[model samples]
Each structure stands twice: as structure tokens, then as C-alpha cells.
Target: MDDVTDRLAQLERDDEELVLDHFDRRDAWELGHRLAHVALERALPVVVDVRTPAGILFHASLPGATADNDEWVNRKSRTALRFEASTALLGTRAEHVGFDFFDQGWLDPADYTVAGGAVPVRVAGVGVVAVATVSGLTSADDHQLVVDALREIMAN
Candidate 1:
């Protein structure tokens, strides 16, 4: 439990540092490909989706990923965009608040999910401009992959 807490904390920190100075359609396309490449490199079947507040920018379903994974991507991305936090973190928050988010019906489970893999794509001055999401791995792994890729993308 402590380890999980520690990891979530680190993810929060990483999120803070990963904000982009600018993000555009090209960035979204490139980032989506990068995420897909990373998943392929890891031999992980995944679906990647990037979206802005207005609409989706980039979406890809890798080999071995299914329509189910696409659904997960949609729901998880909704969770992140609405909360402006990672979906996994939202799950932890739901636990801390002593509420079963689904049972409470606070959000329509059909449209939103508290599972991991969705990350808000924040801009340094503009707030969350989009979300970079990956589905089909453990929540923690999904979160870490986005964070790792963002770190690399932002650093260069």
C-alpha cells in the first residue's frame, strides 16, 4: 500500500513537470505515434488516444488491441479530462473519499471510468489542452508510460 502511495505521489510530481509550452495538432499526432511505438517496443497491445477539450486529435488501436480497448480509452480519457488528473489518481481519491464512484453514480460509468491509462496533457500557461491516453496495461504501467513519454518529449 505504501509502495502504491509512493508511486502515485511520484506520478503527481511527474505530471507537474510534463506540461508543454505549446501543443498543436502536429504535437498530438507525433505524441500518439511515439506512444504507439513505445507500446510496440514493450510488446504491449494498446490503444492510444489524444484529445483536446473540443475533440479527439489522435487515436490508434495497435495490433492485438480490441474494440474493448477503444472503449476503455474513451472512458478513461473522460475521467482524466474532467478531473484534470490521471485516472489512476482519481481512483485513489475515490477510495480516500470513502465513495464507490460507480455505486454513487456521481458520473455515468458508461461515459467515464476511474481506471488508469488516461493523463491530462497540460500546457504551462494554458492549463489542460488535451489528454494523452493509453489502454491495455495495468493502470500503473499505463500511467507510467505516458509520463515517461511526456518527459522525453518535453525534454527535447
Candidate 2:
């Protein structure tokens, strides 16, 4: 948890706008949908996951998002659990640790492509509590959509 916090803090320092105002499951879902729609509009597949106190609260797969992408979401969720970090961070950390979190096990068998496009949603100062991710596009583009969606959602 400290590691997660430190990383988030670093991100906040690097980009003050990265700080989130916090949100609940409903808001997360709405934001996730917005992100999914954006990815779909670009003809890129997207997958969204909203974690809640009761468990995962919502999931959506846009057109062109493959079954493998769904599986990668699951894997990312699991990895998030293991690391006590956001799925996005977990994927990044995995790469730093010399393992491609998105290319192992079921992910490799599927059309899973992991590079970017995952974000952790947090309730202000509470740390990461959910994740929104997209696939089927360049990792950079996927990540940009997630970031843009969050910015839009938070601005509203």
C-alpha cells in the first residue's frame, strides 16, 4: 500500500491534474462507460472494470474488444489484488520486475496486448479502489483514453 501511495504521490507531483477528487461505484461505472465509448469510437476495443466493496460492480466490453481482452482484464484485476495496487500500476510494476504481466498464462494464449491504457480509480486519499482498462489499440492510445475519460468525468 505504501508503494502504491508513493507512486500515486509521484504521479501527482509530476502532474497535479492527476490527483483525483474521488468517486463511488456509480461514478466509476459512468466514467468507465465514457472511456469505453471513446475507445469504440476510435475502432479500438476497450474493457472496463469497476471494483466495489461488494466485489466487482461493473464490466463492459466494447466492440472489437476480444474475449482475450476480457481475460486480460480479469488477470489485471487479480494482479491488482496480489499487489494491493491498481491494475495499471501492477502491469507497470510487472514490466519493471522483468515479467510482462499481460503476456503470461491465459493472457498469452489470448489476443492480449498490454502496453498502456489502464487506470486506477480512487476515492480521494483512500488509495486505488478500482480500475478502468482498454485494449486493442496501441498501449499509449489506450492509456490516453483512460486518462482523458477520467479528466472529463472529474471535470463534471
Candidate 3:
């Protein structure tokens, strides 16, 4: 949590700790709105998206955000959901391993990115069922913002 060395550990802990008993459309709505409201309260220009493998349950683009942010949400979410881990974790791991996403050959740049902005939504029994993503801030900031919101959701 203090530096890059700890980022991977923190992200992994987030994946393990931010577990939901269950998730559905209603849960997505609540969590998505929670993220959006926090961004709005802080006057952040961002897009927030929450979606399951079945489909998207909630999506919002705040003022000062654009379609580009939406695309980033898509890519980042895909990366997070693909591995059931946070985008930050993936990116950090890739860097630690000395291979960019392209060298891995398993990802298409258009559909997936290692950027840090998405966190998989894990259910207690169902595993990772969805992802909550944010865009328009720095990658780390975006990832942390989602993590904070998820923590809030878990706390309540």
C-alpha cells in the first residue's frame, strides 16, 4: 500500500476481502451509484460502469467525461474480469514480469488493457461475476477510487 512493491499485495487483498454475499442488478445499481456520487461530490470528470458477464447493470458518464472514458472503462473492465483481478494488479504484475500485455499474446489491445481502473466484483459463492470500472483520472487514482467505494459498500 505504500509503494509499487505493495500495490500488488493490496490489490490482491482487495480481491479477497471485497466479497459480496450475492450480486444482482440491484446491487450493481447501488454500487455504481455509490461510485458516481463520490466522483460527483469531488467534482471528478469520470465515467463509472458496473457490469456482469451477462450484461451491464449500471453505467454513468458524469459531466466533463466523454466517450473515451467509456472506452477505457470497457477495456479496463475486460482486463479485470478476464482474470478476476483488478486492472492495477494485472498491470503491476505485467511490469514485474517484464512483459507488456502484448507479449502475453492472450489479449487484444482493443478489447483489453492493463491500466488500473477496474475491480472485479466477486461473490462469495459465485466468484468474480462482474466488474466496477472508472475512467478519466490517473490510472492509480481511478483504481483506488473504485477500491474505496467497494470498501464502503462492504463496510455497510
Question: Candidate 1: where are CA atoms >4 Å away?
Answer: none
User: Which 10-residue window in model 1 sums to the lowest lDDT?
Assistant: 3-12
Candidate 3 residue-wise lDDT, 47-122, digit = tens? 9999987788999999999999999999998888888889898888877767787776777999999899999988
Off by over 4 Å in 2: 1-17, 84-115
Question: All models: lDDT?
Answer: 0.85, 0.61, 0.89
User: What TM-score, computed on C-alpha atoms, does each candidate reach?
Assistant: 0.92, 0.66, 0.94
Candidate 1, RMSD to the unseen true structure? 1.5
When summed lDDT is taken over every stretch of 10 residues in candidate 3, the lowest stretch is 1-10
- Tens digits of per-residue lDDT for model 1, 1-156: 676677667766776787898989999998898999888887898898999878999998888899999999989998898989888888866665576888967789899998888989888888988999999888878888888888788988
Candidate of highest TM-score:
3
Which lDDT value does model 2 have at 109? Answer: 27
* Candidate number with the higher TM-score (1 or 3): 3
Q: Considering summed lDDT, which 10 consecutive residues are worst modelled in model 2?
A: 106-115
Model 2 steric clash total: 2
TM match of model 3 to true structure: 0.94
